[model samples]
Target: DQQVKQNSPSLSVQEGRISILNCDYTNSMFDYFLWYKKYPAEGPTFLISISSIKDKNEDGRFTVFLNKSAKHLSLHIVPSQPGDSAVYFCAASARSGSYQLTFGKGTKLSVIP
Candidate 1:
């Protein structure tokens, strides 16, 4: 069974608008959540992350929020731009300090100009 799941296969947002991607996890041991953005023919790059202890984390135009009790998390991008279009993967790891991660299927985000 997939521990992490991205229900929406894709999303479309208008430029200068907000883009929100959602992820859900079934593994309760997961204590950290990360978002990765991947462009075509390139490796996934780390975007933003949040710990189970905190409800939210932000950097520049990206923000990640975690709801520990709900086993849900979301990434929000404000003023979405064309460059922001990519496949976003949601990943999780336990507190065991292992580098290994469980990843969701990913949500492809398209920002329309």
Candidate 2:
């Protein structure tokens, strides 16, 4: 079973437009959530995170919202730029002393110039 799922394999948006990415999880035990942006042939870098205690988290142009009731989460990028084009991964962990993260396959975002 996929503990985390990113239904959309890819998304395209014009520069300076909002880009929204969705994600879902099956494990209700998961408590900590994170979003990572990655480029080809490189490791993912942490973008933002939200704890189960909160419903939303934001960082500059990036924002993440978590809905525990639906076991769902989403990432929003405001005024997306060509540089924003890359793979975004949603990850989660159960917060039980295990730092191991469960990641979605990934969603590739392409910003057209």
For each candidate, C-alpha RMSD in Å?
1.0, 0.8
Cα error, residue 96 of model 1, in Å, equals: 2.7
Candidate 2 lDDT over 1-113, as tens digits, reads: 99999999999999999999999999988999999999999999999999999999989999999999999999999989999999999999996767689999999999999
How many residue pairs collide in each prediction?
Answer: 0, 0
Against the hidden reference, what TM-scores do the models get?
0.97, 0.97
List the candidate 2 regions with Cα displacement exceeding 4 Å. none
Candidate 1 TM-score to native: 0.97
Measured on C-alpha atoms, candidate 1 has an lDDT of: 0.95
Worst 10 residues of 1 by lDDT: 93-102
Q: What residue runs in model 1 are displaced by over 4 Å at the alpha carbon?
A: 97-99
- The lDDT per prediction is 0.95, 0.96
